[model samples]
Target: MSQFIQLHLLTSYPPANLNRDDMGRPKTAKMGGVDRLRISSQSLKRAWRTSEMFKSAIDGHLGTRTKKLGIEIYKKFTEGKVAEKEAIEWAKSIAGVFGKLKGKDSGNADAAEEKETKKKKGKESDKNPLLTLEIEQLAHISPGEWDAVMDLVDKCISEKRAPKLEELELMRKPEKAVDIALFGRMLTKNSRDVSIVEFGEDAACQVSHAISVHPVVIEDDYFTAVDDLNKHEEDAGAAHIGERGFAAALFYTYICINKDLLIENLGDNKKLAAQTISALTETAIKVSPTGMQNSHASRAYASYVLAEKGEQQPRSLSVAFLKPIESRKYDDDSIAAIKKHQENMDKVYGSCADFRYSLNAITGEGTMKELLEFVTK
Candidate 1:
């Protein structure tokens, strides 16, 4: 089996803010001495991992990322008729096994202040008293760990007592959480038993920020909304007006997968690893960032895909666009440039990859099914 898998993709979007900056304009990056529209790696990964394609492809092998585990536990216990005080204590204990508990000085000031104000008014605070039981940061809990935690919760509820020390050994090597295995996670020491926190798994995949292959200029779309109930004779003006930034471009995306690390992270389950690779590949090619999607309706699939597999050190083919492609025949020219760059690299580096397969929608050279098989098989 190959040690690494690399993917180079070209996708085009039309007049959309696929990813945005703090100012609500499309994100941009300076590349090849020109402004290029950008979609961050974080945005890309989030979209792929959360997409229905990925979820359905690898159902039950996903992890939940959350900071409210304690709150959920507390609610479960209280709803099970456990005493408020007991519920709080049990939830805190269980949650502490995952990460540091939020303390009075650990950024729960708003909740604390609200509780005190309610007390001063001689009324109960509507906030759950166990709100502080939450952890300080988001914990990516594996499915196995989640199951263990839930089992302990059920046992505690049945016995009407707190979880025993042995029962709190919740952390487990990730075996079923495909997302966690792919993206990785880190868990800090919890408030309970500082020595019990397990180390995190390193990510098996690396993703690059998708950037346009050609120069771009952010444009503003000024528009208005007319109230449906308004009469044209009474008021000929629009009821609402706004402006938003958008851009259209062909983007280049790169991804590298450490196949060995992925299999190891999945407990050496080669079948699951292959399944994961297929799911991830399809999602990455088909899923679009959700930013301003409803307004812009910009969704796209990769027009060209190149998949390579080998033990040789992986490298991106982004240098192909160091000189932006012309708009006259941008798609075809971009594809030719990428292929030429690869050939040039092989001539110098003596073949950067052992094998490669390509799917060119413009020329209709390969099919998606064939590309998936080429990479995963």
Candidate 2:
């Protein structure tokens, strides 16, 4: 079996804000001394992991990333007819096993602001006082850990008491959570006993921020919304006007998976590991970031895909685009450059990969099934 699997992809999107900057414009990076649109690794991973396709493929093998575990626990206990005060305390005790509780002194600015906003609106924010039970950070809870937590919740409600210290040991090796095994997660030490907490897992896969292979010029789309009720000539003017930033580009994405580490992360579950790789690879090739999709509808599949497997150290083919591809023959040139670079790299580095397969949509060279098999097999 190969130790490493590297994927190179070229996908094109038209006039869309696939990923956005803080200012609501398309995200960009200065690469090779040129401005190129970028889709952040974080954004890409979130899209792939949360996509319906990935979720359906690995339905039972996913984890939930949330800070509302305490809130959920409190609600569950309350629904079981537990007293409000007791429920909050019990929920805190259980949630604290995963991460620090968001207390009055926790200095969580966002929570504070939300509470203050509710107060200003003359709403009784304390109506759901359990909101304060939320944790300080998002916890990635595997299905196993979640089941354990729920079991403890049921016990506490039935026994009419808080969870025992031993029962609070909710951390479990993620045998079923493929998302956790692929991306990994960090769990803070238990507030009660640091030694009792399971720390974290190292990510078995690394994703690069997808960047365009050519220079980009972001453009603004200015338009107006019309009011159908207004029929008079004086009311012919648009009801609302706005402008949004957009750009079109062909992006290059790279992913490297440490198959050995992935299997180990899943507790040596080779079958699950293969499924994870297949699901992830398919998601990467098919899923598009949801940002501004309603307005631009910019969904795309990779036009060119290169999948390589080996025990050798992985390297990205991004260096091929250091000199931007000309717009005249952008897609063809970009693909050619990548192929040439891989060939050159093999010559200089003595075969960077042991086996390789490619799917070129432009040339109709290979099937998706064949490519998936080549990588997962």
lDDT of 2 at 2: 45
How much does each candidate deviate from the true structure in C-alpha RMSD? 4.3, 4.2
Off by over 4 Å in 2: 104-129, 170-174, 190-192
TM-score per prediction, in order, is 0.90, 0.90
lDDT (Cα atoms) of all candidates against the true structure? 0.87, 0.87
Per-residue accuracy of model 2 over 234-324 as CA lDDT, tens digit each: 7678899998899999999999999999999888999889999999999999999999999989999999999999999789999999999
Candidate 2: residue 182 Cα off by (Å):
1.1
